[model samples]
Structure formats: C-alpha cells, structure tokens
Target: MSSSLAQKLETRAKSLGFDVVRFTNANLPELTGARLQAFVEAEWHGDMAWMPETLTRRKTPTAMWDGAVSAIVLATNYGPEVDPLERLTNKTTGNISVYALNRDYHDVVKGKLKQLAGWFASQSGQEVKV
Candidate 1:
C-alpha cells in the first residue's frame, strides 16, 4: 500500500513536537468500515444519539467538512505530576476520564493550538480556524 497522509505529515508534525505519528488513509477500507457499520447496527451507541446521527461523518471525516485534506490529531501529556491512573482504580469515588484528570483540555488544548496556528498564520497567509 501507499504511504498514508499521516506518514507524509509525520516528518513535519514531529518537528512540531509529536514524539509519535501514524497515518491511515482518510478513505475507510471496506473491512474497517464494515466493522463500524456492525457496531452501529448492533445498537452499541445507546444514548449517544449524536453517534448515530454522525455515523457517516465519523466513518469519513471528509463528510464532516469539505476540503478536509488532513487530520492532525495531536496527543499530549495531560497527566498530572503523579501517576493519575492509580486514582481510577479506587472506585471509591467517581471515575474521571483519564484526559479530564486536570483542567478542561478543550480550553487548554484549543488555546495552545490557536497560539501555534497563529504562529503558522504569521509565517503563512492562510486564515486559521477550527
């Protein structure tokens, strides 16, 4: 198979602070798409109405937005000073999402992304938006 867009983006994305990078074709392969279809057909989404409503978009991100040439999914260290995973085992209290252990990542990550995208925009003339 040909190298994926992620692979092509990896070299530059790594320079942008990604320690690890991988690429899959934006187009879903039949086998994987069939698996996703099976999951939906089996009613696994339950109360997640949006999951069903956006099934096609989730399966193919291009449907979510036009001219969606790339998906730069960034993973970062949102953990606390300690091994936060330990807290989840207690079950004595409510279980929090691992990523939500700290401040709301949406605000933090989006702010940081805007900053970086701002810098990129300064360098290039593209208008940046989420």
Candidate 2:
C-alpha cells in the first residue's frame, strides 16, 4: 500500500478511537499453521469446531482472498474506566467478561471499520473488506 494511504488509514483509525493500528503481509509464517494444528490436535479449541474447519483460511489471510496483499490490524480500547477485576473481590457485583460489559462493541467497531473500508476504497480505488 502507498505510504500516503497508510498514513490516512492510521489517522482515521485514531479518530475512530482505535488504540493501535498495524500493517503486515497477509501471508503468515508456516509456524503459525503448525502451532494451530498442534493446538487443535490437543483439543485445546474445545467446542470451537469452526476453528478447525477454517484452519487453512485462518493460517493465511491471502488463502481466503487472493486479492488481499496485506492486512491492517486495528485494536480499540473499550475497557471500563475502573478496574473490571475489582468485581471479583466484591461478591455483590458478579464478575463479568470485559467484552460482555460492552455488548454493543461489535456494532461500534463494525461501523468504524466500514467507514475506514470506504475511505480505503475511495483512496486506492480498490475493493476493501473489513
């Protein structure tokens, strides 16, 4: 990707409240697939049958889409203002997963991703998928 486009993407991601943004090639190392296979073989995935079913695609992003040359990984910080682990000590408030605390996180991230994807398409004149 062009440096200008990448700079724009990073700026957009920051504006969208994303904490971190990274770019990497779509092709993962062979070690990744080996480790995933080992994890599955050990039954560590448990009931996540989809993990094994889509192992190939997951190991290599380009395998899922031939046109995808690179990947843009963005992480958003939607953590609670206060310590979530503090609930574990207080019996009155049951402990809950951090992700569960913000149920609408998926929608919020998806909307931002869609907006970034649109911007990327507009800048690169290429199709983008979030």
Candidate 3:
C-alpha cells in the first residue's frame, strides 16, 4: 500500500477513536504458530477454550482466508489516570481495573472497527472483514 493510503487509513481510524493504527501483511512467522501450539499443549490458555478451538485459523491471517493480503491493526487505550497499583494498596476501596470502570471495550472497539471497515471498503473499493 502507498504511504498516502496508509496515512488516510490512520486518520480515519483515529477519527473513529482508535488510539493507534498500524498496517502489516497477513503473513506471520512460523514460530508464532509453533508458540501458540506449545502454549495450548501446556494448558497455559486457561479457560479460553476458543483459543484452542480456533488455533488453526488463528495461526495466520491467511490461514483463515487465503485471499487475505494485508491487515489493519487498531488499538484503544483505557489506562487509568491514577496508578492501578495505588488502588490495590488501599484495601478499603474496591479495586476495579480501568477497563471495567467504563463501557465494555469489546463492544466499543468492535463497533468502531466495523464502521472503519465499512468506510475503508467504500473509499478503496476493497472488501473488508471486521
């Protein structure tokens, strides 16, 4: 992708409230898949049964869809203004993670991603999947 297109995508993502936006190819290193397999075999994933269930597809973007050639990564920050550790020290006050203090980020970020994906597909005339 051209630098101009990337910049436009970044701008659009930020407008949709994403704190960070990055672009990368769909391909992943073989070690990534190997590490995931090792982690799953070791039962390190805990209760996230979906991790193992989707292991094959999660190995690489292309593994899920062969047509995938690129990826648009987005991130949102939910850091607390005060140190989370400080809250932990105060036993009287219940310690709630910053993420829990606000609306569910899974819903929020997923909504934003879908909107961004729609806009990108319209602007670039390319199919997008959230």
Candidate 4:
C-alpha cells in the first residue's frame, strides 16, 4: 500500500479512538504457526477451544482469506487512572482487573474496526473483513 494511504488510515483510526495503527504484509513467518501449534498441543491456551479450532486460519492471514495481502493492526490503551501496582501494594483495598473497570474493550475496538474497514473499503474499492 502507498504511504499516503497508510497515513490516511492511521489518521482515521486515531480519529476513531485507536491509540496506535500499523500496517504490514499479511504473511506470517512459519515459526508463528509452529509456535501456535506447540502452544495448542501443550494446552497453553487452556479453555479457549476456539484457538485450537481456528488454528489453521490463525497460522497466517492467507489461511483465513486467500486474497489477504495486507494487514492493519490497531490498538487502544486502556490504562487505569491509578497505577495498578500501587493498588497491589495496598492490602486493604480490593483488587480488580483493569479491564473490568471500563466498557468491554473488545466491543469498543470491534466497533471502531468496523467503521474503519468500511471507510477503507470505500476508499480502496476493495472488500474488507474484521
């Protein structure tokens, strides 16, 4: 993809609340698949049955979609207002995972992804998947 397009995508992603946006080819190293396979065999994923179920597709983007040639990575920071380690040191206070303190990040990020994908598809005249 052109740098101009990448810049536009990053700007749109930031506008949509993403803290970071990166672009890369869809291909993943063979070692990535091997590592995942080993992780599944060792039951490192635990109860997440879907991980194993989707292992083949998870190995590489092309496994999921033959036409996939590029990848757009997005991230959002969910840092807590107060340092979690500070709370950990205070035995008198109850501890809660930072994720539990706000709206579900998966849903939040998914929504933004959908919007960004729509915009990108329209701009590039290509199909997009989340």
TM-score of 3: 0.86
Index of the highest-TM-score prediction: 4
In candidate 2, residue 17 scores what lDDT? 84
For model 2, the superposed segments whose C-alpha errors exceed 4 Å read 88-96
* Best of the candidates, lDDT: 4
lDDT of 1 at 55: 83
Give a tens-digit lDDT track for model 4, residues 23-63.
88999999999999999999999899999999999988898
lDDT of 3 by residue, 1-130 (tens): 7798789999989998889998889988999989989999999999999999999988887888888999988888856667778778777888776778878878888999899999888888888888
lDDT-based ranking: 4, 3, 2, 1
Tens-place lDDT digits, model 1, residues 1-130: 2254335445554555545554444566677767887899899978888877878877776777766665546566665667767877887798766666667977876776666566545655555454
Q: What is the TM-score of each candidate against the true structure?
A: 0.54, 0.83, 0.86, 0.87
lDDT of 2 by residue, 32-85 (tens): 989988998898999999999998888778878987888999998787889877
Candidate 2's error at 30, in angstroms?
0.8
The true-versus-predicted C-alpha distance at residue 118 of model 1, in Å, is 3.5
All candidates in order of TM-score, best leading: 4, 3, 2, 1
